[model samples]
Structure formats: structure tokens, C-alpha cells
Target chain A: MSLINSTATEALDLLAKGQITSVALTSAYLQRIADTDDQIGAFLRVDADAALARAAQIDQRRQAKQPLGKLAGLPVAVKDVLCDSQTQTTCGSQMLASYRPPYDATVVARLKSADAVLLGRTNMDEFAMGGSTENSAFQLTRNPWDLNRTPGGSSGGAAACVAAGMTPLSIGSDTGGSIRQPAGLCGVVGLKPTYGRVSRYGLVAFASSLDQVGPLAANTTDAALLLEAIAGHDTQDATSLDAPVPRFSAEIDRPLTGLRIGVVREHFTTGLDGEIEHAVRRALDVYQSQGATIKEISLPHSKYAVATYYVIAPSEASSNLARYDGVHYGHRTDRAELLDELATEQKELESAGDREALKNIDNGLVRMYRRSRAEGFGPEVKRRIMLGAYALSAGYYDAYYLKGLKVRRLIRQDFDAAFQQVDLIAGPVTAQAAFKLGEMAGDPLAMYLVDLYTVSANLAGLPGISLPCGFTQSGLPIGLQLQAPPLAEDTLLRGARMYEQATEWHKKKVPI
Target chain B: MAITRADVEKVALLARLQLTDGELKMMTTDLSQIVTYVDLLAEVDTEGVEPMAHAVEVSNVFAEDEVRPSLPREQALANAPGRNERGYLVPPVLGG
Candidate 1:
């Protein structure tokens, strides 16, 4: 296979055998990115010189027969939301367009410790707020399968880079299907590990409770390899799980004995694209042939996932985003003169002993805060902040934010009940395949529905994987999602691997 | 409940976002549709359910009070938009 198209596992084998050097592998990926990223828009920045230097160092270490990390000599792309210290992490928003972190995200640090060459940072929705990646303030990441169509977002660039053969592995974050949705739309493997499975120390927070970091790869095995390397406890992230990290790559090939997969009846309801449902059912049939049994199950409260998510995520986002006040860091408006004028007026009022008038005067600092945010963020981000502020505001907190949390509990209960009878729940990753770039523009409600089937996993803090199942009539890829109980990524990867081994769906290549 | 321009303005102030007249109009319509859609949550019976704050059950994750080297002041303030030698510069908070 060409170096650009080789899976991370295959490339590692070649590198270990001394047949291929990390320099060669990294160069091939960088070249491919340079050639295609202009059209695909998968990356915000590519660190070519630094990547080459790192690869050369890895090659030197291997020549000396030194100890190496699991992902040594492999190239990996990370979403721009991750802080790398070496590159600017923008989160695809103007708010941080020029802001550079002084530290690396836990995942980035992990990837580096694994000896994986950092290829570059990929584009994403501003603060991961939107699904289509159209909310990216910098560039539009188009689906590699079809240029005019969107690569499902906010991990759109992460998935597209892998699908377009720019990189063998990429790291993406999932707040609500950001990884899986785009991976499905791009015909690559994407995994959203359980909520606390990966640390989130330097990841730019959108929704603190729902966000997670995971891998996107060409196959389940690569995803497993990347997951094993990054999944562990970090003192920097208090929510990081202290449990033992399993050897996912080693256990991925083990076939389950009498695997019981649950198909949620609510998932196949109206609004799901017929072709996606058909493809998922066909995947279930493939599993049955492998001695796995499919059983009908119910997650009755899943219907409220989108509703609950919009409220809860935004409420958390509103609170989390309050830090970008232009005082500490990030974009600050140039309104010093305005402050000076306000200061002069206040001094005059104070000298006149007009204490009441001084109290009523507009605070220049508050106006600067408003103007800075308005100038910094994109429309979708502004809208979510507005909605979240409204929901969490004094009078509506109980009605909106608290009520959404209560429903979130019910959603988790539904998953807990269903998992009692089944090891994994299988369903379509999205209602439809990749849509036209502008298809859902100007309509945020329709865009929110794209996450209907996938949000429940994040809500319940379960591990979910999206792998290629089939394709639409127009040739866009369809994804089959398998969700496991919290911290059951071992089972999740094995289940995805079983389906992958039995079928040729994952082997399909993008036309790009 | 339908969101009005007044509600959008109020929320915008709370969020510290200055919206133009055009944005206020658009946000009023968009938020109304989204709020109505998310209102579907009210149909579900969540009586007696405790509000879930976090996915996993975790509490009081305290760390040892050990002194460690912190980020250098220069590195910490490297990304500041407006800063002096010691701290960030912002608009006047207490007027004069």
C-alpha cells in the first residue's frame, strides 16, 4: 500500500521492521495534506518543519534500539480545540484566533509521549457549538467523499483528514457526536470514549460535563491503538477516571460468545433516513451471521435527548465561556478611549457630589466586555450563548436548566435499563448522510436534529463508536453506531471490530 | 415559550454580547424556534428524579496541597491581548 494510505497499524509494522522510517511516513502524510487540504479544508495549520524534525528524532531513536512508545513513528492530527503549545489552538473561532496556549492538552501530551508525530491542528466548529462545521470561523471542511457536501462536525476536519488520506490517525473531541457524526459522514472509524476515560485539562471547554476526547482512524484497530495510548488518569483533570486502562488493541480481535445487541425501537422511528436505517439493519444481519443475536429494546426517554442536550450543554457553555471577557486573555476590543471618556465623566460627577448620577453611569468595562465578545465570536456561538444565558438566568433556571438536568437523569436510566438485557446497543449514527454545505444553514433546529440518535450516549456517559456500514444511493457513507455501558470501550472496540472483519464496508476508500 | 426581541436583548446583556439590530431580530426568531423545540422536554414525566450534574458519580476530588512550579508569568501572559509588564490591561472598572 502507498505510505499515505497505510493504516497506522500497518505503518507501525513497517517502521518496526526497519523497512520504512518515520521520516518517510511523516513526509508522505505532510505531502498529501499539502496537496489536498486546500480543497478539503481539513486543517487550520500544518507544522511541516516541526513534524519532520520530530520524525527524524524518532528514526534516530529507533536506529539506536531504544525504548519506544506504542505509537512511535506514526503521525496523528488533533482537533484545534486541543492545546499543543507549539501551535495556535483556535477552536475554529476568532475569539482565540491569535491566542496561543502555554501548555499542551493532556491528550496532546499523551500523543507526544507515545512518540506520535504531531502532523497539525484540524478545523472545527467554533467552540464545538455546531454540528456541520459550517460554524468554523476560519474555513469550511468539505466531505472527502463529496466536496460540495459537509464533513459532519465539529470534528469535521479531524475525520476528513483521515478519510482524505492526509493522516492515518487523528484525535477528536465529542460533546454531542462531534467525533462519531463526522467520522460516519466521512466513512472512517471514530470513537467517543466514556466521559471520564480521557483527560480534558487543556481542551477548550464548550460543555464541561459532556465533552470527551477520542480517536478517529481508518479502522477499529487503529482507533484501539490510539485509545489505549491516551486513555488514563490525569491529576490535572479532576474528573479523570482512576480506573485501569485496558489493552484495547490486544483484546479487539476476541470474538464475543453469544453477543446480544439491542436495537432501540425509538431510534428507527420517523425522521431517520431510510437508506441509513437499511444499512444499519444490514449490519445487524452481518452480526447475526457471526453468531450474535439482535434483540428489540426500548429507550423511551431518548426522544428528549436533543431537547435536554440543548439546554444542559448551553447552560454549561454559558458558564464555562464567561472566562473569555477580553481582560485575562484572548481578543480584546480597542476601546481605551471610551474608557477614558467614561473615567472623565465619573470624575466630574464625583467632584460635584452627584453620587446617584455616578451610580447610574454606564460602566465602560461592561460595554467593552460586550463589544469584545460580539466582535470575537461567530453567529452560532453568539446564539448558543444567548440561549444558554437565558436558560440559566434567574427566572428560568428551574424551568429550563434544572428541568433539562432532570430529563438527563431519565435518559441515563433508560440506558441503564436497556443495558441490563444487552451488552451493546446498535443504531444508525445519524439520521442521514453528509448534506450539502448550505443545506441546513440559517436553520439551527434542523441542524440540532442531526444529533438525535447519538446524543444519548454522551448523556449517559457511555462509550460509542461509529464505523462505516454502507453507503447512500448517491454514494455518501452510512455509519453504524455501537454504544456500550460506561468504561466498556473494550467491548465497544471488539464489537466494532467484529462487524469490520466480517464486512468490506470499512475498506471502501474516499474518491478524494 | 416564544422568545421576543426584548428577551434576546436581556439575554445578550447577561452573556455580555453586543448584538446589532439585525442580529437581535434574527436571534429573537431563532431562539424562539429552538426554545419551542426543546420545550418537548416538558412533556416527559421526570417527577422525583434528581438532576444529574455529572455523568459519573464523583465528589470532593481534592488534591494534596503541595507546592509545585507554576507557569512562568511571561508564558502565562503571552496570549494576553492587552498586557503590561505585570498584569493584563482592561477598560476602567471603577471609572476614574
Candidate 2:
């Protein structure tokens, strides 16, 4: 085993004991990333300079006898979607390729204040659009467990990095299973907190009502610790909760007795692969052994989660993305002149134009705007953006957006009813293990279907988590999802901690 | 009915994205397939059921009326691809 392949908790203990200096640990991971990331493509941009400087600052603080934050000096990878002022914050697209945020995102600033070394920015689906990192415009982040398979996305890179030991902890966003799906495929723990638990001010918009930032780590406790650091309220984000952040790690090891884990009858039906189902069933057995009761419950609207998510997410995305028309912060050029057929576009550009205008302008800018966004964004992003625009258009708004909102209410109602009978929901995190990179490429519906089991939590605005339940027949990892009602991450985490304590899946690492 | 090539092209233009003929053909086929797949929702009998917008029943997620600090002008302008005396520099806004 590589000495560097340690859990976040172990790494912190080492840091506190002075067994490894922050600089040394950061450099070791940076060097490891340098050696392996070319093959894995986990990092979009590795900021060696900032990482080392942050480490040195932490070391200086240690020598000065300053009180260190619990996660101080640990190197954690930031997903490119979140803003990091000192680093190039590209949301894996050329639109924001040169776009720099004037200030760090709330989470990044929090990490900086805690003296954590921001290791680098990990790759993700452009605008967090797809289920595979394949949607990344820059590069594909492969599953480290099986290099040819996808790590799952849009947090694929974060999960891949943690699984491969490139970093002990990484943060990823989940509007609809972006964090948990990747974590499941990569054999790590990913948590999607209740909506508004984490601030979204610095995150590039995808689906505002659904988007949340969370962490991916090797184990449940590490995932909880990372969440504790970033899971508080900020006045800047209206959606941020004003509630106190829970002590996630403190109760992780708490007993699972008396916890009722409901196995969703809909989650393990004809569509789910047998291997993944068996894995989850095995995980359920562990909970039963731990004095937890398992009950079969039905979530009637569960079947509609993905369809509801697609419509609702696209509708929200259509509106939120209206600001990026080669105007405020993204791509720009001189496409002032327009053909008669393009008069509508001309009017739009004129109305929304920022002061970057020169006296003479050609169709070059409109062309560039079209081309850059076309070439810069991946297929999934384009699909959603188009779908969104159509849905939000005046003609289709009621049919699509409004209709989707009502269905969303039903979806949430389904979860509320289920939670009435059970303390929490548990099932396989995904229908299957990680597949080869090209396995589902070019099939957008298939990609969306992968989130069938996970999207309901987002629709319900409930907190959910995916932890390593088992490996598939092909030896790829599978995830088992545990969900709780709003503010019930403690129960979900506790149940996961108990199962993890009984299993060895969390201890397995990729050969890389 | 299947989504036509013209539909795809029109949607692309609305998104301010340019698609080549080759891509148009590909997307036409892909979108038709996706639309057909999503047509599964049509069978769900959603007449009286309201379409869901947000999962939670949150009505208004409003930031308080407070004048918090904005990022400094220079810092905000730091990443602008082009800039002039007043602000971000670009081409003419109107035609003669």
C-alpha cells in the first residue's frame, strides 16, 4: 500500500502530531497527481504554487502556536465549478475559461480561512450538465479502478481523485446526483446535503433550485468532516439555510440501533441490474445485523424523478443561463453587422451589449459566440440548454416549466409519505457499477436514466448519501444510497458508518 | 412526430450556438430519439397533477435588502478579456 493512501482522518492526525508537515503532504499528493493524472484526467488545473504557499502558511501557523481548524493544512481538491480567486475557475468550459471571479466562493474562502491547501481544480461536466465526465470540454476523467470505464460525473474527477489517492478529500456539486453517482462509480463516499445546506453563490449556475456543493471522500467519516467545513449558511446566498451546521463526524460512529431504513420498493425493480441489487441487499443485511429494522416501502412517484428532473432542471437552466451571451463575463468578439435573416440576434446583441464595443464590428463575434459555446460546451450541456430554452419559451412555459413544478410537488409529496412510515430510505446508489468510457456515449436518455434512483432526493430537497456497498461481478465498485428527511444527515451518516464499519469495501483502493 | 432538422437548427440559433450541417443532422436524429424516450411522460396521466418546479415548497428564496460589499472594480475587471477607459471594451452597439 502507498503510504500516501491514507484517510482524511488519518492524514489529519498525522498533521496534528507533526508526523508530516503540511508542505510535505501537499507536495506528495501534487507529485502523485502529476505522475498519474495524465492518464486519469482528474484535475483540470493543478495550482502547485498556491497549494505550496498555503501549506507553508499553515506550517508557519503551527510553529507560531496558532489554533488550527480541524481540517487545517489538509490538501483538498476543489471542483472547477466553484470559484477560487487565486486559481483559474473554469467550470470545464471555454465560456468561463478566462472568466475569473473577483472573490473566492464561500466554500473556497472558508477553506482558505481554515488554512486548508486548495490542491487543484478537478474536472467536471461543463456547467454540471451530464452524468459522465465525458461531458467535460477539456478532457475525460476516467475511473481509476478501471481506466477504460467512466468515473461517473459531473463529480467524476473528484471521486476519481479520492479513489486513486490523488487527494484525501475533494468537493463536488450535486444538482441531481452529480456527486453521489460519481462517488458510487468510483467507490468512494459522496454526500448531497439538503438544498441550501451549502452556499451556491460562487457556483456557476446550472439549476439554481437544485444545485448544492458537497464532498467526496474515501469513507463516510471523511465525507462528513468535509461537509462540516463547508455546510453552513452565508448571507450572500438567499437559499442558504440559517440553521446551525451539525457535528457530522461526532455522531458518525454512533450506533445504528432503532434506526428504520426503508428499502424503496421502486428502486430495486426490473430495471436495476442484479449485481447492484444484490450488493445493496447485502448492505441492508449489515444494517439488520446492527439492530436496524428494514421495511419495504413504496414511493409511487419515484418512477418520475428522472423525467421530472430533466424537465425542471432544463427549465431552470434555460433561465439561469440567459446571462451568458458573449456579454458579461464569457466569450466576446466583434459581430456587430448581421444578415437580414439574423436581425433578431442583432437586436439581442445590441440590447445586451457591454462596453467592449469598437466602432467597427463584423459577424465575427456572433460567429465566435456560436462556435465557442458550441465547441466549448459538451453534447449534454447543449442538449439541456436547448431543451431548457424551449421549455421556458412563452409557448411552452406552462406546458413544461409550470407543469414540471407541479410534478415536482408530487415527487416531494411521495417522499414525505414514504418518510412517514420509515425513518430513512436505503437502496443501491446506482443501478450498476462503472462502465467503460464509451459504454453509454451518444445516448443522452441512457445517461439521464442513470440518475433514476437518485434524482428524487433533489426533487424532494432531502439530504442523501452514497457509500461503497460492494463490487460488481466484474470487480467494479457499486454504491448503496441512504437517504433521510431534511436535517436528517446524522441518521443517514450513522447508518452508513455502521455498515462501513462492518465492511471492507471502503478500504479497497485502485491499483494506480 | 419526430423533431425535424429545422427545429434543431432553430433551437440552436435561439441558444446563440452555431451548428454545422453535420451536427444538425446528428442532433436531429439524437433529439428525435430523446424526445421519443421522454414521451414516456405523456402516458403518465398528469392532467390534474401539477407540474413540479422545486422539490421543497419554498416560495421565495430572497436575500435581505442589505448593501453588502461587491468585489472591487479592478478585481471584478481583472478577468475581462478586453477593457477600455470606462469598462469592458467591445464593438459598436448600434448600426448606422
**Best candidate, lDDT:** 1
By TM-score, the best candidate is 1
Q: How far is candidate 1 from the true structure (C-alpha RMSD, Å)?
A: 2.6
lDDT of 1 at A60: 99
Error of 2 at A470 (Å): 1.2
TM-score against native, each model: 0.96, 0.92
List model 1 lDDT by residue over B4-96, tens digit each: 898898888889988999999999999999999988887888789999999997888999999999999998888888889998887667633
**Compared with the true structure, what per-residue lDDT tens digits does model 1 show for residues A1-512?**
67977788989999999999999999999989988999999999999999999999999999999999999999999999999888898999999998888999999999999999999999999999888899999999999999999999999999999999999999999999999999999999999999999999999999989999999999999999999999999999999999999999999999888899999999988989999999999999999999998999999898899999999998999889999998888888878655765778788999999999888666778878888898999999998898899999998998899999999999999999999999999999999899999999999999998999889888889999999999999999999999999999999999999999999988888886
Which digits, one per residue and each the tens of the lDDT, describe model 2 over residues A375-484? Answer: 55666777788877766665667666676677778778778888888888999878878878888887788888999888888888899999998887778999988899
**Model 2 - which docking category?**
acceptable
lDDT of 2 at A19: 81
